[model samples]
Target: MFKSLLISALFVLSSQVIAATATNIAESAEQVSPLLPGLAVPNIELKDQYGKTVSLAERFKEKTTVLIVYRGGWCPYCSKQLANVQKIEKELADLGAQIIAVSPDSPEKLAESKITSPNYQLLSDDSLLLAQKLGLAFYLDDKTAKIYRNKLGVNFVSLEGEVKVALPVPAVFVIDTNGLVNFQYANPNYKVRLTEDLLLAAVKSVSEQ
Candidate 1:
């Protein structure tokens, strides 16, 4: 009876912590405080492009991970960045690193995005749960959200059908097999991104450590 009570108490505490984190999401992209180097990457489970659950921690355990957080498939800048990464996917793999891209698109949308490459994995974070936990989630302003939905035809629905108006500031994190972030780069400007050359250099540096 005591052990069961302890388990229930721990569960409730964790739920409260997550709720607190969710409530603290930044109001704008510029205000987001992305996770920094030396911090342990959050071990959250997110749906892959095929709707299969993939754990961030499990992926980290396999090898060094290059985690790319993008706004969505609807963003041209995001697409370009993904393509640039593809060009150096082999180089990264040769250095014993793997790449994983996460975005606020559902599994179906992820499939439609056609951003997949054989060398890397794409995961869906429609609810922005992982982003929030990493301090990288921000609420899109009403005007921008409306423009995206009405003009751009970008669907904001989550996997459970609820609308999500949050996006992750475009960021890249190099995390080691132990899940410790080795380097990070995040910028609120949607048009600007870390270059493929810099990303490859970052991965190479992490692999040596």
Candidate 2:
């Protein structure tokens, strides 16, 4: 009977701690300005996998931009989503849209990632500035962050000694040449992703307009 009570008490304590941490993360996330339809997308400069500087506005100046924001390559779900996007690359191109995938990975890590699409641009958002501007950036709870660094080998710090592990919610945005967002999909659940069919429909609808 005593052992049972001790286990129950421990479980209750653990649950409370988890709840509090989740609440804090959610509260901090509330400050992010979520991108909505018709909002002008922010123009952010990012480094491509090839170590070249790229401007988001200039690269897709005349074409519809299909922007995909993901966590770094260390995330299996993110890698799978990116690969799925590549599988539909031709369809996206046929709709006159260019796909760009952004993540907090460094340029070196971005290049190492095998997720590739023809004419696809992989931009490094190591500073997470773009994610912050879009109101998609969120801080991982302390325990989760520690696990990522210690177990997952995802050190979200730069050589300059800046820690930047806070990440964007995996998101997708279809933006017209006018810099206005036409479609956006963002979920707090990192495991879920926008479907290819939905993305195609959105691109077609916006390109027609």
Which candidate has the top score in lDDT? Answer: 1
Model 1 ranges off by over 4 Å: 1-22, 115-118, 152-164
Highest TM-score model number: 1
For residues 82-151, write the lDDT of model 1, one tens digit per residue.
Answer: 9889888899999999999998888988888665665599898877788887888877788887877786
Model 1 steric clash pairs: none
Minimum summed lDDT over a 10-residue window in model 2 is located at 21-30
Alpha-carbon local distance difference test for all models: 0.84, 0.80
Question: For model 2, what is the C-alpha lDDT against the true structure?
Answer: 0.80
Q: Per-residue error at 45 for model 1, in Å?
A: 0.2
TM-scores, all models, native as reference: 0.83, 0.80
As for model 1, its CA RMSD to the true structure in angstroms is 6.1
